[model samples]
Target: MSEQAQQTSNSYRSGPDERGHFGIYGGRYVAETLMPLILSVEKAYKDIEDDPSFWSEFYTLARDYIGRPSPLYLAQAMTKHLGGAKIYFKRDELNHTGAHKINNCLGQILLAKRMGKTRIIAETGAGQHGVATATVCALFDMPCTIFMGATDIERQKPNVFRMKLLGADIRAVTSGAGTLKDAMNEALRDWVSHVDDTFYIIGTAAGPHPYPAMVRDFQSVIGNEVREQITEREGRLPDTLIACIGGGSNAIGLFHPFLDDPGVAMIGVEAAGYGLDTGQHAASLSGGKPGVLHGNRTYLLQNEDGQITEAHSISAGLDYPGIGPEHSWLHDSGRVSYAAVTDDEALEAFQLCSKIEGIIPALEPSHALAHVMKIAPDLPADHVLVMNMCGRGDKDIFTVADKLGVTL
Candidate 1:
């Protein structure tokens, strides 16, 4: 048997061991100065891991603040259009701030309060996480600083305005393609310089120990909800699950809950900016190799000399060079399949869904929908498929309009 098959033959959910090593993919590899802070964050998280009150507050906020149990709606029009598997949309796009980013933001902000950190720092790409972080900070009256790419700020102007309206201090990073990776680099630098009073909430499930796991645990609400809702409606679990991945928070959130279910398959769609052949894409797992970045060992788009390369994606959110370490492990272990969707394909799917379902999906999740379009028609009609509508496309209207040559 293959090593990957051996890894998956056993339990799939028990991972990241004591030191947060998910089959050598996840580990804390930070500077010595940040080690204590990282360890402290880990300890604090461990203390609240099984605490009833902490989770009580979390659920209460999920229900009242961010809108929990978003919805599981079968896309009858899209399903009939596909003429194959019944497609169900996990409506995370309907959440507060119009995206699934609010789920992780809410959890980490609460943790920040528990840690007694008075200031919050975060990195954003597509700006949804920035808006969500700013929203939570506004609610708690905590000062927030968001590091976003100058490029992303221009393309995602609406979300930038929303973040500013929420009173977040927006720092535009101009280094390294001026995208998500650069924004994350700036956020980490800020965290190290002001470690005393600031809590850095890394947006995705990509960062060092406790973060990838912590983010997954918080976002797992999506998959957990899918399990209950799908079983209630369909009387069985979904046959397949799909979601887009950059640092892979949303995809991991939906797939983690069902990792041990051998019968259920999961597919993670990565952004192929132009096409994989052009080397101008962000399909890390499909095109990159394992390397340490943002403090964890994961598949990264790097050159032969081991320098990280720039990733391109029409969707600002999926423009990262590496994925979350857990996702790297899952991809290697063969528990989840990774696919690439080109910018053109995603753009087509974006418009198709908007016209058919009246649900304008963000460019990120549109990548997943593109893959679903490719395979759904080939599957049996009774086959059930669930895809995470991770974010709304209102933030992308301008970008879409420009791409379609319709000036706004």
Candidate 2:
């Protein structure tokens, strides 16, 4: 394919900028204390990526270790209930650490090894990323530290325990609102200090340039396998693909390779908290305005002074104050549609999936399932649809039960 042909493809991420900045959206946004370290890792990633041997080894490790061909299972019963749309699931929940997060974490640890880094640092909100990061560090024998909000430490105790079992040092950030934001602040502070041998493995595609792109690349296997499986089963692409967007990594990864197919639609669901108009939400594209933050220019949930506002999503994973730059661009270009699903609807869908499909999905991905409830009913029975059921919801049952007043 010509460069022009490839350029026009529906990929959410683009550009010639090597440092991961998509236009002005992504660039180094760290404190001056960490600039040199960020740049050093950037250089290492570029150099190692250019070497065929490293790519070969990385691909081998990915296919074998992380279970690259995560099954694309046909949601037969769910589809029949929808009464028209063929719903299949890209089952990343069965992955090594039990989500798409592990794909990126393993790749990052491999990169860290190549870079001669001896330590790994990461920040987590709901702790999925922290557990995945810690797990990979254990496999590589690298010292690991995971920063998490003190509040999340308690809410996601299972993940914290998993991280400890994997031997990661956990620091519960107590500052600010004591959530993902505070944990991120603390992690960044640590990066600025331990610039020498630390590699920070971000969980999603939202961070600075290469991160969004890199994470997408790591997670893109979801879509890659989907393409092959869809061809074998349905012989054509579905009319739409739906995935929840926290930092937008999974959605973008699944949507990127399929971007240029004008006939196929991509939907990214965000958390609506109570409702979008209630001032308690995390629907960045649906509710936020353009602003610069965290080292890149992008749409930010902000206040009157343009200070970034904290975001609210019942799903801690979706409680991000800013979005990946590529998502902002895709929304602006009309290449993708962004929607919001309220917490009540998400929880209902979460329960429904477990009750009906025998699969319990994370609250983050449950946002996508809520939209599926709305969408599948409208499509023709023969039409196709697939959702990224990102993780299991065993970690969320108690909180969900308390919220909905379910005795169980």
Q: Which stretches of candidate 1 lie above 4 Å from their native place?
A: 1-9
Q: Could you estimate the TM-score for every candidate? A: 0.98, 0.94
Give the residue spans of candidate 2 off by over 4 A: 1-13, 16-19, 406-408
269-375 per-residue lDDT for model 1 (tens digits): 99999999999999999999999988999999999999999999999999999999988888887889999999999999999999999999999999999999999
Error of 2 at 172 (Å): 0.5
In order, what lDDT does every prediction score? Answer: 0.94, 0.82
Candidate 2 lowest-lDDT run of ten: 1-10
Best by lDDT: 1
